[model samples]
Target: MAVSLGFASGAIVQEFYVDDDVDRSIRDSVEAETGQALVDVDYGDVVDGAIVWWRAEDAEEEDLADVLVDAMSNLDDGGLIWVLIPKAGRPNSVRVGDVEEAAGIAGLHATTSTALGQNWAGVRLTARPRSRR
Candidate 1:
């Protein structure tokens, strides 16, 4: 199961990785694949390991999950993936709760919290994602 961050209809978000180099690779790959530039990138960490966050365009639910899972699965031991679903409206507050539910659906564990003085929402999801090996 992967932790999910709910969106408010076409809401852009970010993808985080536990490795800097891996982060760069993911950012570059996502931009190249989507032909869209990242909104931003930042340093951070999660239960799995160190991490960096990169802004991403709004994508479909399954497509977004597949993209994130693919990028995160390449790191050492395959680091975890986190998607930041910022608040948009009255329903934006549901992102964290929705992500928790999403993680359960995917058979992954997740934790959610708010930042920026409770102005933004984020979710961290972890799991032993299936490997091609």
Candidate 2:
């Protein structure tokens, strides 16, 4: 998982922002692989990366654009975000199209997506480069 995300150990410690409702196992694995604990969304510190656990109902409850924007705000420059949603056929699963749309609105692009296991789909997000004048 760390390899796929290009995580590397460096002099500065790497930190990840963990959003709400993420699967415990996935979060644990990430923490173990990254060699550090994850900070919750309220951390208010710029992190190297972020993980957003979302559901279909969450989209209805609040704007996905808002959530993505909030997550992005907590990221460092060149940071990344992994938006994990329930896989197709799973309870509370959201459509990939919707996620992509929200990502676009948040000034991000989906770099890739992969199945996290039997139950979850993970999308990697990166910031869009500023447009040249």
Candidate 3:
């Protein structure tokens, strides 16, 4: 079996796994739920992932963030996960910085940049070790 990792957002801690397809089903589900398009980046074998962005909703960002964190935690074989919440001035305008911050809030280590390429990029957060405490 693959190594399991512990993930957290605020008070929640859950197990996670890294899959072969890098959690494509999560992307598809998010797309179907939000009716948004997703983009994939070439991390060149060193990494494999995708990004899903959509128009902002009346829902609070914190609520959405919680949903995203829980989704990542529950996703089958999911390790590297990124959730972006950019300004809602336009559709699919999730800035890399926004995603980075959300990843951070999810207690994930990440790096991002719009200059990297495309409107979106793959997830940067990977499975992290559980706290000793």
Candidate 4:
């Protein structure tokens, strides 16, 4: 998962912010593969990427937008934010449209969606291009 996320051992610490509710197995896999520990929400430094666990039942569009914005605020320019939501048929699963709408509000766009784990699906989000007004 670390390699897939483009992480590698380097002189600089490659930090990835982890939002709440993500499975411990996923975090373990990443940590074991990257030889680095994932940082939590309280991390004060900029991150190379982020993994955000979200549930539709727990939030509204505005809530998700806020979370996404805050999660990416300390991210690097080229950083990727992976939003992990419950899979279809799973409890609290989120619709793709809801994710896209919230991402748009957060000044981001969804580039891809994939199965992140047995119970979770993931959407990769990147910053939207700014208009040079």
Tens digit per residue, CA lDDT, model 2, 71-114: 87766667778888899999889888888999999999998988
Give the per-residue lDDT of model 3 (tens digit) for 1-133: 1211122221122212222423355444444543434333322222222333422341334343454465454433333454433333444445555555656676666643322122223344554554465
Q: Please give each candidate's TM-score.
A: 0.41, 0.82, 0.39, 0.79
| Candidate 4 TM-score versus the reference | 0.79
Give the Å error, residue 70, model 3: 0.7
lDDT of 1 by residue, 55-118 (tens): 2333332444444454344433434545545454532234456566655665556754544222
The candidate that achieves the highest TM-score relative to the unseen native structure: 2
Between candidates 2 and 4, the one scoring higher on TM-score is 2
lDDT of 4 by residue, 1-133 (tens): 4325444442112323334556677766666656778777777887767777788765844388888888777776767777878899998899877888889999998999888768788888887543467
In order, the Cα lDDT scores of the candidates are: 0.42, 0.72, 0.39, 0.71
The numbered model that scores best in lDDT is 2
Clashes of each: 5, 0, 0, 0
Shift of residue 10 alpha carbon in model 2, Å = 6.5
TM-score of 3: 0.39
